[model samples]
Target: MVSITFLGTGGGRFATIYQTRSTGGMLIEDRGRIHLDPGPGALTNMARLNMDPGFTDAVLISHCHPDHYSDAEVLIEGMTRGGINTRGLLAGSVSTIDGIDGIRPAISDYHRQLPSRVLSMRAGDEADIAGMRTRFTPTRHTDASGVGAVFETSAGTVSYMGDTAPREEVTASHEGCRVLILNVTRPFGARLRCHLCSEDVPAIVERLRPELTVLTHMGVKMVEQGPEEQALRLERMTGSRIVAARDMMRLDIGDSLRVNAPTLL
Candidate 1:
């Protein structure tokens, strides 16, 4: 079975600063453990869930933004047993791994050496990550080289639409996935540049029609407006199964998807 854990769901600068919700990112447990994003509070939340970072098989960062990469190096440290061994994969966007457009690399050179393999991934690049067929998908975020990812897991295809505005190519890349995790930073009528808003998600959900569409990475406004209510509106608009991910909420995917009760911090 494949299981997904939402470590933290808050996003955007203000939200991250005030921390209305945690920004720990998501964790996927299938054949192996893969941590995506690893933003602030990732380690702390993992401890809350009784997860050992040393067992993580890979770390996937989508962009250079702090909300997406802050805890990555430390996680790499844990994955490598405090750098005593090179044991895991570190895959990230060009900007996140190699730096681009003045944005510095997220994983330091010292930390980069800790992972058994380091991939500076771009959109369309594919690799074997902890037994999953992983593909780097494109994003139209402020970080020009930012990328999302799609994982072909044993249970089904899981796609993460990283920080991006609603775009045709973005939707096309995530098509035919059983699960689509969107970084919905704004609520309805509160659109922002390079970020997905509530209004922009309906068409994407309608077109792809995944078994589940998870709304996460909410900003202050979206959180204040009530993510659950926003999700309900989107579900009504698209006739799709949509959920607003809470911190520590777990989803088990086997023959079907099941949302488990969240474990609070």
Candidate 2:
């Protein structure tokens, strides 16, 4: 079964440091373990949680922002076993691969030349990774990781809305998604500049009516109301499963998916 785990749950400048809180991205393990968005706290957070960064069979960088692709070089080294080989696939924006202001060359030439493949994609392009199809859905956010990802799994389609505000085009692509991971960086009614806030989710929820809507990539300010509570309110408001994304949390894909964390089982 294909399973996904969030390595870091918070996003933006402030990373959770109190104990085990994380930021920005996650680890997806299907036939292989793929690391998505190695943000500021990704490596260290994975280490703390005993999830090895070296085991990532593939790496998907959503963009070139520091909070997203900052650790790409480090994680790439680990994934290739200190540059021994690049057995994993690397997928992201062209800037993240070819060359962007200072973000280019995140992966070494030797590793890039390895068995792995790198595809630079814009909006509406579909790429295949480990039997699952991924489409780069355009977002308003500008960064090295230009577009968000839509994962088409064996069970169903899941949309990873990377740092997008309320956009009809973005939500349009999310229609019929079984799982939707929205980057609700702020609490309800608190309007964020570009990131999504809690209150803004109902529209997407009501429109898409996804079977499961997971809220993640929170900012420090969102910590005040607590993500779990926000998730509960969101569930009541949207009539959908509002999951509070947390580090090491896993979900299995099947006829019906089940959410389980490392500590839970």
Candidate 3:
């Protein structure tokens, strides 16, 4: 079985700064523990939930944005057991691995050396990690090198949209995925460039028609407007099972997907 835990669901500058919701990102447990986008509060959130970072077998950063890679180095340290031993994989986009103009590389050279192997990924790149085949999907964002991901796991295929605008390529890339997670950062009618809004969900859901759709990475506007209501609206429009992600929410995926109610930790 493949299990996923949402450590944080909030996004945007204000939301991340004030921490209206946690920004620690998600954890995927399959052949091994995989940490995705360990942003601010990642370590704290993991500790609060009694999740040991030492067990992580890989770290993935989707972009060079602070909200996506701020705590990555620290998580790498944990994965490598304080850098005492070189271990695990670190995979991400070109900007994340080598940085773009005016943007510092997310993972430092020292942290990059700690990983057993570091892969500089681009759209359409595929790599095997922890027995699963992962494919990088393109993203249209401020970080031009940003990419989304699709993981073919033992249980099923899981797709993450990362921080991107809704594009036809994304729909094509994520087709046939069992679970689809999107970073919807704004509410309907409030479309923003380089970021997804609630208005974009229905089309993507309709195009992909995944078994389940999870709405996460909510900004302050989306949060105040109510993610649940937005989800319900999208479900009605697309006829797909939709749910809003919350901190500490757990999902177990096998023949079917099961979501556990959020619990305070």
Candidate 4:
């Protein structure tokens, strides 16, 4: 069965200190493993969890933010077996792919040449990777062009909200998605800018009404507040099964995602 692995559940730079958990993001393993948003501790966390980067077929970045795209180039090298070939797909936002002020061309020439195909998109653009379909969905945050990705996998459709405040169009992009992964950085009570609070989850759940709603990209505040309890609250309010993600957690496709732990390291 197809499965999604939560490599990291924290968000922002502070996530490093909150290393009791990880903030790297998710991995979708179907016909091939697809890593999304390889943040600060992604590769390391994967190793800790006993998952291999060389097994990946593609890496998708939502934006150029350090917490979202930092380790991509390094991960790419692993995927290509130390730059021996350019076979896997590399998809990222425009800013993430092309450097701005010489910052984001993060990967070297040898690495960029490894992807069999590379797609640089800002949002509202779709590309087919092998058999999986990916669409760059729009968001309200500022990131050169502000983009996120919606993956139409063989199992089901998923919309990963990289970073953004609630926007009218964000949910519509994945109108009938079965899984929606949102970067919920705040707890049930706090109010913030360009980030989502637990209170905002029900609206998304009611609107998109995905089979399962995943709360990710959390922060220390949320961690201290206890994401698990807040997820339970969100479920109570939305009447949808809501899950607060943990680093290295795995889930299979469908309304109820079965959990699997990486092999003990």
Q: What is the lDDT of every predicted structure here?
A: 0.93, 0.76, 0.90, 0.79
lDDT of 4 by residue, 1-265 (tens): 6788887888865765656457677888777788888887888878887777888898888777778877898899888888886689888777777766545565566677887888777787888754678788888775656587777877788778778888778867768888888899889778678878887888888999888888889888888899989999888887898888877677888545676654432
lDDT per residue as tens, model 2, 82-119: 87875677887766777676656555666566536777
lDDT of 3 at 257: 86
Q: What lDDT score goes with residue 113 in model 2?
A: 65
Model 4 segments more than 4 A misplaced: 17-20, 100-103, 254-256, 261-265
Against the true structure, what is each candidate's TM-score? Answer: 0.99, 0.89, 0.98, 0.92
- Which candidate wins on lDDT? 1
Off by over 4 Å in 3: none
Across 46-122, the per-residue lDDT of candidate 3 in tens digits comes to: 89888899999999999998888899999999999999988899998899998888887888899999999999999
Residues 1-265, model 1: lDDT tens digits: 9999999999999989998999999999999999999999999999998999999999999999999999999999999999998799999999899998888898888998889999999999999998899998889989989898999999999999999988999999998999999999999988899999999998899889899999999999999999999999999888899999999999999998999879876
> Order of candidates by TM-score, top first?
1, 3, 4, 2
Query: What does candidate 3 score in Cα RMSD to the true structure?
Result: 0.9
Ranked by lDDT, top first: 1, 3, 4, 2
RMSD of 2: 2.7
Q: Output the number of the TM-score-best candidate.
A: 1
